[model samples]
Target: MIVITAPTGNIGRHLLPLLLESAPAHDEEVRVVVRDPARLPGAVRARVEVITGSHGDAGVVDRAFEGADAVFWLVPPDASLNPKDAYCGFTRPAAKALAAHGVGHVVGVSALGRGTPLADRAGLVTASLAMDDLIADTGVAYRALANPSFFENLLEDADSIREKGVFTDAADADRRAPLVAVADIAAVAAGLLLERSWTGRDSVPVLGPQDLSPNDLARIMTEQLGHPVRYERQAPDELYTTLVGYGLNEAFARGVVDMKRAKDEGLDTGVARTADTASRITFEQWCAQTLKPAVLS
Candidate 1:
């Protein structure tokens, strides 16, 4: 059995069909733990066994993990909640359930910057790494898909990009950082879950093809969307205030500030992508195919 959590989320939505298509060939049973069964597409609901509840619930995960060989884990973000409680608190129950249920393997969505000097101060990244540690301690074969800032994050401000022809962030305008597409992240997770031979704990850095700064992205956006687009670097204080205004609590807002600061300081630049780690989608392709359409829509 292969258990998947957050099956309706950005990555999970893409992951579900890939796993289902391969299930018949591999003879794998797929199970999903979701808060809202209704949110699952009708096609998916008919294909996999569904456990209706949040994965953070011990009962939900324990029931879902029955006879499970591999599990895809992703702790969805809640900006209104405390960072530690949101990440590590939610993970503890699932980790305990994994040990109790004897699930063999787990693929968790986590961030980059595990061993770096800046990791300790990288706010949400720090909390996520700590969550990874708790899961690793459970003795399940674990692989944390350590990703950089997602290209999908741009869609959150698609309205601004379309209306004002501008996007904003706290990072330095010229500091290039890896940005990955969630589709590629899902693909890697599906591949790992399909082949359950791997063992022990490790971090898989799913860096996209190359680094691109926000300025570089704006230039690309201009060409791709056939309109003027610009990158605006907000002051750290301004960014924090803006996030708080968006309903994020102060702690979570501070975490976002710290993460952006770490990126500007080159925290994500340290890891060079290996052949197996590098995702094929480039920022330009993602802009043309994903971001451009999102802006138009």
Candidate 2:
């Protein structure tokens, strides 16, 4: 049995179809822990066993993990809590449930910066790494997909870009770092869950084909969208204040600021792209295929 958490999310939504189609050939049964079963497509709902509730809930994970062989673990963003509570605290119950249920393999969605000088101070990224540690200690074969920022993040600025020909972030205009497509991350997760051939714990970085700066992204967006586009660098304090104004916990707001600060300072640059680590998606391609449609709409 294979279990998936947050099956209706950006990553999980893409992952479900891949597993449903392929896992059957491997004699695997797919189960999903979700808050709302109706959010699942009708056809998908029929294909998998659904455990209704938050995966962060101990009772939910206890039931979901039972008889499971491998699990795809992705924590949904919960801005109401502090970084530690949102990440590690959410996983603590599930970590125990994994050991108790004897589930052997787990592939979790996490961030980069493990083993770096900045990782310890990178706020949310730090909490994500600690969550990976908590899961690994459960004696499961764990692979934390250490990813950078996502191209999908730009969707948040689609309106801004459409109206003003601009996108915004806290990163310096020239600070280059890897960014990934979430579909690619889902693809990597599905592959690991199906094969389950690897043992022990490690991070599988789904770095996109190359590192791109904010200016690089703006240039690509302009070319792809057939219009002038520009990057707007926002202050970290402004980001924190905005997040807090949205009713996010003060600590969580601080975490968002710290994470952006760390990324701008090269927390994501700790990993070198190799054939094994590099994923096959470029920002330009994403802009044309994904961002263009969103912006044009």
Candidate 2 lDDT by residue in tens digits, 106-166: 9999999999999999989999999999999999999999999999999999999999999
Error of 1 at 83 (Å): 0.8
Give the C-alpha miss distance for residue 76 in model 2, angstroms: 1.1
The C-alpha RMSD of each candidate to the native structure, in angstroms, is 1.0, 0.9
Clashing residue pairs in candidate 1 are none
lDDT of each: 0.91, 0.94
Model 2 score (lDDT): 0.94
TM-score of each: 0.98, 0.98
